[model samples]
Target: MIDTGEVRIQLRKGGHLKLERALGARVTSVRGTAWITAERNAGDVVILPGDSFIVPCDKLVLVGPLSGTVTLELQGARDAGSGALTHRRGPIAKLWALV
Candidate 1:
């Protein structure tokens, strides 16, 4: 378990934040709305206040505010080497596993 203090990041309009070498991050929008884009993921995500987004590992993520300034709370990266974590599967794989 990694103990970390809460961090607040402010993003101006059309501003972005680049993160590297992080397993993942738990991000919450405290004020206004934020737009998030990842390396492997297509399209942009809009998160509003009281909402959260997870930034996956091994990818570059860009977070920007849609308008005005957005206040975001970062809870740090995920734990390393936790075997319980698994990749997402398609519907076919899920059905096969049930057999």
Candidate 2:
């Protein structure tokens, strides 16, 4: 489920998600690998697990899994309350803690 402040999405191989006017939003790869390409950007970015990329401008952005399934966390600029960031546990993190 997507909260008000952030969104978590899982994409299968060959599937993609599009975000429009997502300026300054931070996209983090929680699992697997994904590729990010933004409109007006010169190049595409590949993010592995635990990697994050900040959208540089308000443009159309596409994110897709490079292989297998990919889980992503997107936090918008307004999501940062009082300029402080909060950490949330992903499934992998939770599983790791139980191990």
Best by lDDT: 2
Q: Report each candidate's C-alpha RMSD, comma-separated, in the order given.
A: 13.1, 9.0
- Give the alpha carbon lDDT tens digit for every residue of 22-99 in model 1: 455677999989888878777878999999987766576677788999998766533433212121221111221222
- Could you give candidate 2's per-residue lDDT for residues 1-99 as a string of tens digits? 212355677888877877665567788999999999989899999999999999897777788899899999877544222122222221221221222
Q: For model 1, where is the 10-residue window of minimal lDDT?
A: 87-96
lDDT, each prediction:
0.64, 0.70
Return the TM-score for each candidate structure. Answer: 0.70, 0.72
- For each candidate, how many residue pairs have backbone atoms clashing (under 3 Å)? 0, 0
Model 2, poorest ten-residue lDDT window?
Answer: 88-97
Best by TM-score: 2
TM-score of 1: 0.70
